[model samples]
Target: MQKRSVILAYILWLFLGQLGIHRFYTGRTGSGIIQLILGAAGWATTGILIGWFPLFVLWIWLVIDIFLIPGMCRNPE
Candidate 1:
């Protein structure tokens, strides 16, 4: 398996993490798609308070991913 870079992953996470672009770059397509959908839908439904939950969760997840990303790189598929 090809090894991913921690630095690139951090950069992606810093910039595009909100839309799950960092997950995609890290070879987590499933997570990326889920985040993408949630982010898009969250923006679309912003008029209601319910939409903020997913975005909030995603933000927390992304922040946690800062530590998790190195592990992901260590065990790539």
Candidate 2:
């Protein structure tokens, strides 16, 4: 596998995280899919009252995820 830049990954995660493109770029397909689903859920459910909390959690999760990508990509399989 080719080496991926952590900085680029972080930028993508911070900006287009909801699309899971960052995750895919980092070779984390499972997580990318999960993020995509959760993000979609958050987006679709927003403004429905009950969805507010989940959306907040998802946003926070995305932020944390951005920080974690470097460590995850550095790990040896």
Candidate 3:
């Protein structure tokens, strides 16, 4: 497998973390999918107003991932 880089991870986190692309890059595919679904659902449900909740959750998750990225890049479990 190609090695992961902290730089690339941060870049993806900055640009695509909303979809959990950074998590996928870090080999955390399971949680990545959760983020993916949450992001999609959050956006999709906006018309109903209930989407704010998921979007809020996703935002918090993204913020938390900012700190977790380095460890994920290093260990990648």
Runs off by more than 4 Å, candidate 3: none
TM-scores, one per candidate = 0.87, 0.77, 0.93
lDDT of 3 by residue, 1-77 (tens): 55689999999999998899999999999999999999999999999999999999999989998898888888877
Best by the TM-score measure: 3
Sort by TM-score, best first: 3, 1, 2
Clashing pairs in 2: none
**8-72 in candidate 2: lDDT tens per residue?**
88888878888787888888888778778877887887768666776677778787986688776
Clashes of 1: 0
lDDT of each: 0.84, 0.77, 0.92
What lDDT is obtained when candidate 2 is compared to the true structure? 0.77
Residues 1-77, candidate 1: write the lDDT tens digits.
78889998888888888888878877888988998998888888879888899888887888899898898777765
Clashing pairs for predicted structure model 3, backbone only: none
Weakest ten-residue segment in model 2 by summed lDDT: 68-77
User: What's the candidate order when arranged by decreasing lDDT?
Assistant: 3, 1, 2
Residue 22 Cα positional deviation in candidate 1, in Å, after optimal superposition:
1.6
